[model samples]
Target: MSDRFELFLTCPKGLEGLLIEEAVGLGLEEAREHTSAVRGMADMETAYRLCLWSRLANRVLLVLKRFPMKDAEDLYHGVLDIEWAEHMVSDGSLAVEFSGHGSGIDNTHFGALKVKDAIVDKLRTPTGERPSIDKINPDLRIHLRLDRGEAILSLDLSGHSLHQRGYRLQQGAAPLKENLAAAILIRAGWPRIAAEGGALSDPMCGVGTFLVEGAMIAADMAPNLNRELWGFTTWLGHVPALWKKLHTEATERAAIGMNKPPLWIRGYEADPRLIQPARNNIERAGLSHWIKVYQGEVGTFEPRPDQNQKGLVICNPPYGERLGDEASLLYLYQNLGERLRQACMGWEAAVFTGAPDLGKRMGIRSHKQYSFWNGALPCKLLLIKVNPDQFVTGERRTPEQRQAEREQAAYDQAPAEPQERQYNKNGNPIKPAPAPVVEQARLSEGGQMFANRLQKNLKLLGKWAKREGVDCYRVYDADMPEYSMAIDLYHDWVHVQEYVAPKSIDPEKASARMFDALAAIPQALNIDKSRVVVKRRERQSGTKQYERQSAQGKFTEVSEGGVKLLVNLTDYLDTGLFLDHRPMRMRIQKEAAGKRFLNLYCYTATASVHAAKGGARSTTSVDLSKTYLDWARRNFSLNGFSDKNRLEQGDVMAWLEASRDEFDMIFIDPPTFSNSKRMEGIFDVQRDHVQLLDLAMARLAPGGVLYFSNNFRKFVLEDNLSERYAVEEISDKTIDPDFARNAKIHRAWKITAR
Candidate 1:
C-alpha cells in the first residue's frame, strides 16, 4: 500500500461502502474502506476515473508525500520538499486548504498561509515568477492535513465536491444531496429491482432526486455525464489521452444503456408547483424517456395495475420542527403506512425522514433503520418489507401513540368560548365509556339522485381526465339542483360545496338533506370521511369568500392539465384551483412557450403556472390580495419561476395602467364584482370590461392574443368593442364535458387587434 501512491476518497458518513464498490468496479483493488472515507492505491488514470464515475464520493485526493512534523518551521520545510513545478507553472494561481490541527499549526488559515509561502519561496527563483493566490476557481488546489505531529500533503484532484452534478437548475423547498439520494436508492436495493425488471416510485418525490438517481443506477450510466467541470481538468498532472479513453467508454456505455429498458420509474409530488421542476430535472439528467413525475399525494398512492411489477416505494416526507406541532404530518405518515400495506403488497418500502418518532406514525413495522447524515440533520432510512402480515387492517395503538393523538386532537379542537372541561380534583383526567357509534343515515330519495349523478359524471370525466392528462376536475356542478351542491375532486380528496338552500325550505329539513349529501358523498365515492371536506357557499363577493372558515390551515397539491396547483380544501371556500378554467389553462399552455405572459386578476396564479410550463420566458401575475399573492408565490416557486418582479400585490387595473411593458400573451379572468377595502375602488367585471380590455390590449404586443373570461351569466359584450378589436366567443370550447351540463359556467373570448 505504501509503495504506490495512495489516494483518499472522502464520502458522506453512510456511503463508504458505495464508494468502495465504485472504486472496485473501476479496478481499484487496493481500496481500504472506513466510516467516512476510502483509502486506495490509484494512479492518475484511476483517480480521474473515480472523479468521473463515483456517485458517492465527495472528494478524491492523491497523496503526494507524508512526513513527521514538530513545529511551523518543520511544516514549512516539509511542504517545500515536494516538487511543485511538476503540477503547475509558477505563474499559475493556486489555493491551499488545510485541515486538522497540531504541531503549532492549530489555525487552518495560518497553516495554509505557511504552506503557500514555502511553495512560493521554493518556486520563485527557479521559474523567475510567483503564483498568485486565487481562492475562487484556483488552477492548482493543495491540501495538507496534520494530525498530532504528522503531515500528509495531497493534491485535490476533485476541485469541489462531486455532488454538484450540474443538471439541477432549479430545486424544491428541501432538496436531497445527489450523493445521499444515490446512496439511499442503493441501500433500498434499486439495482436488484431494476435487474429483475421491477419499477420504482416516490410518493413524496420533490424535484425527482431519488427518481433520477434510481434511473441512473438502473441504467448503469455515469452520474457525471451531465457535468462538464472536472477538478482534474485543470491539474497539470492530468493525462488527456487516458481521460479521453475513459470518457469514450462512458459515452459508449451511456448510449447502449439509455435505450435498454423495461424502465418503469415514477415520482409523485403533492406540491403542484414542483411537478414541472421535477420533470425539468429529469429532462436535465437526460432520463426523460425513463422517469415520469406527476402531481399526486401519498394518500392516493398505488402501484399501477398495468405495470404489474413488484418494486420499491421510497420517500422523504416532511419532518416539521417540533413533535407536538407536527400533528397533521402524523396523519400523513399514518396514511402512508396504511396505503403501503393495502396497495403496495409484495413491494419494499423505504422512508427517509429526519424524525424517527414521527416516522413511527406510518403505522408499518420497519425491519431495519439505517442512520444517515443529511447535512446537519441526522436522518434515518427506515426499510420494511411490504406484506399483509407486516401491517393489518385494525392495528392497535400503543398508550404513547394514543396520548400523542389525544394531545393533538385537543389542540385541533380548542373551544371558541374557552370553557374548561371536567377533570378530577387531583388533576388526573377522568374517562367515561365511549358512546355507541351511530350508523350514518342512507341517502334520501333526493340525495340518491345526487349520488347517482355523481357516479355517472365521475365515470364520464374520469375517462376524459385520463385521456387529457388532467388530474383535478369537476364531477358534479349542482347536477341535482335540489341538493344544491358542487362536488369537485382534487386527486383523491372530494370537496363538496353546498350552496346555502332557500329559507322557504324548512330549516331542519334543509340541515337533514345537507347531512344526507355529506353522508352519501363518502359512501358513494368509496373513500374515508377524512378525505371529504364540506363547505357552505353563501352569496358573497370580495374578501368574504376569501375569509377563513376554520383554523385548521392545510393545503393539498393537485394537478390540472399537466400543471400543478396548490389547493386548500379545508382553509377557505375556494380550494385555490378554479376547475372551470381547466380548459383555458390548457389553451394558455399551448401558446405560452417562449413568450412573455401577463395574467391579470391572477388568483393563485394558476394561469401563470400553465404559461411557465408552456416555456414562457417570463410571467407577471397581478392580484390585490396579499394572501392570494403569497399563494401565487408558492406556485411560482414550485414551477421554478420565482422572480420577485413577476408576482405583484396590487389592483390589476392600476398595475395594467402603470405598466407600459408589452406582453406576447395576456389572460384576464377577473371576478364578477369585488368591493375589497384594499383596492382603490370597486371592480365589476361587466362594468370594467371595456376599460380592462383597452388597458390590457394596449400592453399587448403586435399580433398578440388576449384571453378574456368572466362568470356574469346575464351580461353581454359591448358591440362597440368590435370596432377596435376582433373578438370571438369561445365559451363552448372553454367548457369541458364535465361542466357542459351547467352551461352558464363562464364565458370566454379570444380578442385580438383588428
Candidate 2:
C-alpha cells in the first residue's frame, strides 16, 4: 500500500470542468478533466477528504492497477495478480462493476463475473471460505473499466454515490440529483451570494433539493457528513484515525458556521403533495433553522424578506418532451418572468430549462448563460439580473425614451442608501408594497389577425351553440390558410390540433404561426391558458395513432344530446366524444327504439350509450382496446344503463365473424389503417372493407339497417356492394353544422338486404 495514489472522480456529464476545479481545491493534485470524470493524484487523507467534501462528484475511485488486456484470460489474470487479502477478508462480501467493452469482452456482466471469479479464487481459504457476492452493503466494491485495449481496476472509495447525501429518502417524480443541483448552484454563483450573506429562494422547488443544497453551501456543511455507510467503512485499509481527523474538522467547521445567524432561505412548491416531503428533507439535512418550505404556486409566489434584501430567484420548471407541450410551457415560463419582474425587481434570477426556445419567451433578457446536461438532455442556465434595464417591453420606445432609460439604467447600477424600515401598530414590520400589476401579454400582428378570425367564428357559432344547447363544437377548422389548425371548445376547455405543415412551407415560419395561434387562444377565447391542450395532428400509421399523448388519467364529463360522456382532454389525442358525430348519434337515438343495436370498432361507446338512452332492447359494443372498453363501462355507468348493454374487448373482425346474434341496427366505423398486434393481420379499410362488411352483414337481421362510416378522405365505396345490398349515401345527413365547413370530415352510408 502506498501513501499516494491516482484518483478518478466521476460526475454527471457537463460537470467535469466544475468537478476538476472543486477536486483541485480539495487537495487533489494535477487534476485533469475528462468527459464525465477527473483523473488526479491524491494521498490517502486527500482521497478521504475528496469523498467527504466533493459535491460535484458521483464516485471517488482509487486506481489499484492498470494492465494491458487482449482477452478474458488476461482480464482474469490481471485481477488475480492484485492482493485481494489487502483490501477485504477472504470470507467478506464484495461487488464487482465492469464498464466499457473491448478486447473480446463485449458484455459488461460477463466481464464483471470474470473479475469476481479471479478475486474469489485468489481469496479462497483451504476450507472453501471464499468471499461471497453482495450487490448491496458489500464490504468491498471493485470497479473495472476497459478503455481502448487497457483495463483500469480501481477500489471504490465512495459508497453508492456522493449524491445520495442521506437527506432525500423521498423525492419528487423528477428530482434533480444532489451533485447536479450543487453544480447548478455553483454555476449560478450561489457560493459568492452566500458568502455575502444574501437570501435564496426557489419558486418551483420539488422536495427542496435546491434549498437543502443551497443551505449546506451557505452553512459550510459537508454534503455527505451525515452518511453512515461508505465503501471503505469495512475495508482492510480503513485508516479510522485519518478519516476521523478530517471528519472532525468538517464537523467543527459546520458547528462554527451554524452558530452564525441563519440565512433567509425559502422554497415554494405548487404541488401540495411535495410540501411535507420537502420540509422533512430539510430537517434531515440539519437545515430546518435555515430553510423553510411552503405550499405556493408560481403565479402567487412572493418571497417576503426584509425590504432591502435581494438574492437569487432560482427554479427548474418542467421542459415538456412532446411537441404540443411547448404551447403550455411557454405561458409557464412567461408567468415565471412576470413574477420576477413584478415582485423581485432588484433580485437576480437563474432559470434552468431544457427548452431554450421557451426560455426566450420569458420576456426578460438574461445577461449570462451557461450550458449544462441534466442527465442526457442538454439544458441552459439563464442568469438574469432583474431590473428595469432587463425588462422587455412589447411596445417600441422612442429614441428619446430609450436614451433616458439607458441613463437611468446606468444610475440604477450604482448603490443607494438603504430605505428606512416601516412598522405596523402590532410592532411587526409592514409588508412590502404590492407587486406591480403586470399587463396582459400583447399578441403579435399575426396573432391579432388570428384572434380576430376566432372572435368572428365565435360570434357566429356562439349563437348557434347556445340555440341548440351544444356544449362542445368545432370553433375553427383551418379557416385561414396561414393558421392551419382545428380548434374545438369542450365546455370551457379548448383543444387545439395543429395540422402538420407541408414540407413546401418553411418549418420556422410554420412554427412561428403556431406559436402566434397558441398565444392568441386564451385571450380570444376569454379562458385561462392552463385550460388549453394542444397536440400536433399528423398522418399516423399503425400503432402510433393509437398511442396516448399523455398519462394524466383525469377525465372531464361533457354533455351531448342530453347524455353524459367522459372526455379526457389531456390524456389522448382524441377527446372521447367526437363533436362531428353528434348528428349521427342523435339519428341513432331517434331510430333505436325497441331495436337490438350493435356498434363495431366502438371507441368509448358513445353511440351505444345514445342507443341505450333511445330505449334500445339491448346494445353490444366491441373494440380491441380494454382501455376504451373500461371507459365505455364508465359511460354506461354514468348514464345508469349498465344492464343489458354488453362491452366486449377483442378484434372486431374476429368477434364479428363468430357472432350468431342478429341485430335490428348496426354501426361500423373502422379505422383508416390498423395493424394492432392483437389482431392476426393488418386491416386497411379500403382494401378489406368488403370482408368487414360481409362479416358484419351476416349478423344483421332481415329488414335491418346498417350504417358504415370512415374518415379516409380518398375512400370510395365499391359498386359491387350496392349490387349485393341496397345502399344509400347518408353522409350529408350524418354531418352536423359544426362540420359543414369540411364535409369531407367523414363519409357514411346506410345498407339493407336487397
Candidate 3:
C-alpha cells in the first residue's frame, strides 16, 4: 500500500488560501485550509517537496499519530504511542514543542515537558537509551498540539521558522517579516498578478521585503531555494534521494519558466539606512537583475518613461507606530494619495496599516479590507482604487466628484471686487496691504571674528576636559558670541546652560576667556583621572555656533542629588534621557516600594535607581551591553542604592523568557533602531514592540504594571490591545524640560489587569 501521511502547514492567519495554492502547485491534490493552518494528505515525497518550496508557511509538520486525549497524561501517552524508533534514532537529539487548546493544558511549556518525558521514558525502556533534548539545533523536532480534547503529534519538518529565508543579510529598523511579506504579496494576488505581467511597486519599501517577495513569485522560485537547512533533512525517515529529486524538479521548473524579467517590480525608501539592506536582500534572492530599488521619498516616486505599465502599488508605509505623530502621518498619507492619484492612473493601490484611523486621512475609499496579523497585532490591508477610469476619466461623476466641481464653480463665480468698496489713500482697495519685508544688518567682520574666537575657546575647553580625564565635560564661556551655555556631564547627567562668566575683561573677551578658564578647572580639580576615553562634539553647519549648546558626553557617574553624565547637546540635540519616562518612574516608585523590578534596555538605569529608592526589594536589569548596565548600577549607587540589584547583560526578550523570577514592575524601553552584535536578531520598535510587551507582561506580577514606551515619533498603540489590557497614554506626564513640547521623543503607557 502507498504510504499516506497527514501534513500540516502553518502560516500567519489569512494566508491559508495562498498556502493551499502553493500545495496544489506542488501537485498535492487534497489541500484544505484550516483555522490559521493548512492540512492535506500527501505521500512522504510530496511532503518533502512542500517543505522545499512553500514560502508563506511558518512550519510544515508531518503527523505521526492522533488520539483522543483526556488530559496531560493522555497527551504524554499519545505522543509515546508514535513509532518514534521508525522516525527518530534513539540517540538523536530532539526538541518538543506544544500548542495547547482546551485540554486543561494552559501552559504550553508544561505540556511540552510532559510530552518530552513520555517520549524519553518510552525510548529508555525499549532501547536502554533515549534521545537528548537540543533546543538550539535539534535533529528531530516533535510537535505536540492539543485542541478540543484531541492530541495531534507531528514531526516538525521545517525546523526553524521559514521566515528566516537566509537571503536577508541585513535589515533596517522595523523590517517586515519574510513570511508576513510573502503573505501580503499572496493576499494582493501576486500569483495571478505576476502571471498577467502586472508591475508591482512599494514606494515605502524598507529593506525591500515586498519587492523581493514579488520578484520571487514572478520568477516562480521556491521560497526555500536559498535556505541553508530544513528540519526534514535531519529526520531519520527523510529520504535524501527523494528530497534531491524534488529540489531538482523545482529548480528545473523555475529555470524553464522564469527566463523573462519580472514586470517592472520596484521599491523606493527615503532613509539611507534601508538602502543597503534592500540591496542585500534583493541580491541574495537572486532578483537583483529583475527588481530595482532606489533611495527616494514616497511622495516623489514616479515610474520611468519606458516602464510606465499601469499595475499595482503595494505599500506598507509608516503607520505612526515607529515613525511618530498622527498629524504628521496624515500629511504623509495625503501627499502619498495625491501622488498616487496623479501618477498611477489605472493602477490599484493597497496600504497595510495598524492604525485604521489614519486610513481615513488617505482621502480615498477602500474597496476592500483584509484582516491579517503583522507580528501578532491585528492590522488591516486597505485596497484603494486609484484613478479609476470610470470616475477619474470623466465617464462617471460620483458625489465626491460633483461636490469638488461645485466648490470650484463657486470660487470662480465670486466677484473679484465689490462695487461699494472705497479705495485707500495709496490708490489700492480697502483690503489690508501686504506686509513689507524687513532687512537686518549683516554680521560685521568683527562680530564674525568674535564668534570664531568663542568657538575656538569652546574647542579648547573640550580638549582641556579630555586632558583632565573628565568623563563628561562641556565647553562654553558665558561671554562668547553665541548665547553663553554651560555643558556638564558627570556620568549620565548632561546639563547645559549659558555660563555667567566672572567679569574680568570686555564682556565678549571675558566670556571667551571664561570658557578658557573653565577648561583649566577640569585638570585643576583632577577630574577624569582614569583617562579611559574621550569624545568630541561636531558643530552644525550654517549656524555660527553648535546647533546645540549642550554638552555631549557619556555616562560616567550617578549621584542622588543628580546624576552626573556626559552629554552631546550641541552636536546631536539629545543626550538620551527623555524626561517623559518620569511618570513611568513615579509609577515604578509607587509600585516598587518593596518588590522586585525588571528593566529592559535599562539605559543609565535611571528607572532602576528610582525603583530602588522607591524601596524595591531588589532589581534585575537586562540590557545588551555591560557598559549600559554598569552605568545603570552607577546611577543606582549615585542615588545611595546598593549592589542588591542584579544585572544581566543579554537580549531582554530571551532573558525574560528564561528567567524564573517574576517582577512586580517592569520597564521596557528598547531603542528605536538597534543592531547589536550580541543579539540573535535585529530589534525594531514598531514591529517587535507587541511581542516584547507580551514577553514582559508574561513576567509581571498579577497586579504589576508593565510600563512600555518607545521613542518612535509616529508610534501607534496596537488596537487589539484593548481586549487584553487597559492602556492609557501617559505621554503628557513623561515630558521634561530637556525635550521641547513639540518634540515627541517617546510615549509611555501603563499595562495592567490583563
What ordering of candidates by TM-score runs from best to worst?
A: 1, 2, 3
Query: Each prediction's TM-score against the native?
Result: 0.60, 0.57, 0.54
Q: Is candidate 2 or candidate 3 better by lDDT?
A: 2
lDDT of each: 0.80, 0.86, 0.68
**Local error of candidate 2 at residue 650 (angstroms):** 21
Highest lDDT: give the candidate number. 2
Model 2 — TM-score against the truth? 0.57
lDDT of 3 at 683: 76
Query: TM-score of the candidate numbered 3?
Result: 0.54
lDDT of 3 by residue, 1-754 (tens): 2387888889887778778887888767678898779988999888887777778788989888789987777887787776677777777788998897667788888998999988887677454778899997898888978878888888899989888888887886667888888877777777787888888888888888888888887887888876667787677787888888888888987786568755788887755456777898888888888888876555457754343576778988666555434433655666576667667767778788888777766666778788887877788988777755423335357799789778756755655654343333223334333433323223444444544554565466544433333334333323434434444444433344443443553677745544443443333333332431222323322212212333444333322212232223333344434344655665676678767788898865777766766767678888876645554544543343323356678888788778777888888877776666778787777878888887887888888777788767767888878688888777776653323323365788878865
Candidate 1 residue pairs in backbone clash: 273-638
Write one digit per residue (lDDT tens) for candidate 1, span 426-468: 2333343343343455677867876687777777787787667
Q: Cα miss at 63, model 3 (Å)? A: 1.0
